[model samples]
Target chain A: METVKFDLEKHTLREVNQYLHSDASVLDGKAVTIDNPNGSHNIAVGLKADVNVTIQGHAGYYAAGMNQLANVVIEGSAGTGVAENMMSGRVHVKGFASNAAGATANGGLLIIDGDAGLRCGISMKGANIVVGGSVGSFSAFMAQAGNLVILGDAGEALGDSLYEARIFVRGNIQSLGSDCEVKPMDDTAKQILVDLLAESGHGDVDPDSFTLLGSARKLYNFHVDNAGDY
Target chain B: MGTKDQLALVRDPFACKPAIIAEHDDYVAIASEFRSLAHLPDIKNAKVFEPAPKEMYVWKL
Candidate 1:
């Protein structure tokens, strides 16, 4: 269990990566408080340790891309593709996030505390994205498999081309995607959202305010009637 | 002036179009330049606002 404090002068992504890859276990339980982190792209990539990394400032594109087994938390807003293609572990954003927050993510939990830009969780495989704020249009487009939970309003054309993934929204949806439908919340759905919000530090929310969004399975194979819908 | 009025005035580039007609193309160029400004990294610590309780939206996947 090693502790390292990253100042703006001595903090470079290369140095952070080198320390993470070293046998020292760079950030075991210590708080790696980074001051004035001005949109540094790919701040922590390919970290495979059971450690915690907290960035106290805003981050640029793909801040924690391809994370395997590290818990990364960004205290501020994140730019586009914050956790692109992440395999596992958890990434939490405490502020507004840009486009493609968790694109093509295979697994892990991504929590955004503010509004997210367009196309969030696109082509998601199995990752779970929980947004505490509203999302822009075309969210969950071409989603393969995963769960996207929005606690606020969603813009037009939500979940355009969907697979086996499920989306649950607590607010108004401007429009539904091709073959996407609103279904009754089952016990499993309610419990999943309740637990997710609780784990994400949003336990005070009422779970009954949400509505589930998922693929109808009718257009999963492509049909002529759903052509315009897509 | 109220905050909304100030915002409206700040966002009204067309209000001065007649005076800057000769520089209309330059206005477009300046708009592009300003658009690029949005992409620049925040030099200072970006402000973090509390997650709005009522306006918040969530999607569970």
Candidate 2:
């Protein structure tokens, strides 16, 4: 378990990323530490190995975007689109994340210990996002598939134009957007939320306290009966 | 947009839009996203923070 450390102050982001994007034999199961990120964009992104990477400072846009099989931890807040379009692996933000966090991610887990800004998980194909704090407006908008668990309050239009994705909220929701409505919390959904909470470091929280919100299935197809709503 | 005396950044109360404000010894930088300011010199030591909704960020020379 040798630790590979890179100081962004000395090495450019491209150089550090080149090392991360090296041969699988060099990156697999490796522990990497990046010092002085300084809110840089695209740190630890597109990783394909089972490595653990720690970014010691704040990250800019799309940090760890399109990641796979890696665990990236951001010690400070993230700018925009943290972990956006990820395929697999885990991106954990210890501080708040700005707009579009986890947008369009297909797989893996995104854990935000603090609040997440607007449009979180937008258009997500399949991923698990757990936010310990509140989320801004229009989050989970048009998310086709996946699950978003919010422990704190949600801003306006919490799940606007949502599709098949499920949203679990423990606190109050300012409003539900078009095609988003509360669904019955069945045992299966609760179990899934339980696992998500546990994975996001909230295992002790009661799963039953969450409310499931999903698509009403009214906007998928154009029906003349519901034309006005469309 | 700025003129001569002061520069200002505004965020709507709804906060649908995002803005990041960074201050340094050389200048005060603001952008809708942090990526826009990532390439700036000495950015690693700049004071970075998100602007509050409905607050006016004014810079004086």
Candidate 3:
């Protein structure tokens, strides 16, 4: 496997994305490493490959936006929209993440080892986001599908305006969003979280403390009386 | 009042409390203001709920 090392001290985002995209051709089965990346915006956009990219430091906005079939790992914190509109593969952040980490993603997995800002998976479709720490308010807002597993406390209004997505939080939630309710954690849901946490490298955490959040399906289609709830 | 009377009063169906629809309206307005100030484009205009998910274009701040 070929390896490409990107030293952020001397390279630009344009250089990084170009190199990542181009390297996919030369190093078809290689694992690329971007060493010492410091909050660069759009670092690996629109990359389609079977390679693994390890970013050694913090990343700026949309670090792996629209990624397809590439495993991108950031060793530090990430800014907003880190994996926006991703179609497949995985984006792992070893530390905290900013807002909209996987916004509108159609498919893939996002793993954040630390806390995530608001709307972590807003309008997500088929993307699974597992946060090892707390998630800010409005997480999974209007999520159409997929799963969100929070190993820490979930802030207020969890899963507001949700659609078909499942949320499992291991800590307290300040409030549930309109039409969002806490259902009993059944065996199916519990097993799913356990397996997911394991796959995301958080298998040791306890799963019993988690609560599930989903749409009540009452206000799925807006109505006159339901207007008061919004 | 007797305990039963108090219970009846508590459960009275006709008891009318002034509805604060204005509060809801104000909240909506404030939320919209905040969204605007935060530079969040109105997703209502973008029709995010459409059958086919529309790609939202967002730029870095």
Q: Compared with the true structure, what per-residue lDDT tens digits does model 3 show for residues B1-61? A: 1332221112112111111000121122111111122222432222110010122222121
Deviation in Å, model 3, residue A83 alpha carbon: 0.8
Model 1 fnat value? 0.00
What TM-score would every model get versus the actual structure? 0.78, 0.86, 0.76
The CAPRI category of model 2 is acceptable
Q: Which segments of model 2 are wrong by more than 4 Å? A: B1-10, B21-49, B52-61
When summed lDDT is taken over every stretch of 10 residues in candidate 2 chain A, the lowest stretch is A221-230
Candidate 2 per-residue lDDT over residues A70-166, each given as its tens digit: 9999988898899999999999999889989999999999999988988889999899999999898889999999999999999888888899999
Q: What is the per-residue lDDT of model 1 for residues A2-42, given as tens digits with 9 covering 90 to 100?
A: 55667554667788767666553545565455655656777
The true-versus-predicted C-alpha distance at residue A35 of model 1, in Å, is 2.7
**lDDT per residue as tens, model 2, B19-44:** 87779998899887766777789987
CA error at residue A42 for candidate 3, angstroms: 0.6
Interface RMSD of each: 9.5, 2.7, 15.4
lDDT of each: 0.72, 0.90, 0.73
Every model's DockQ: 0.06, 0.32, 0.02
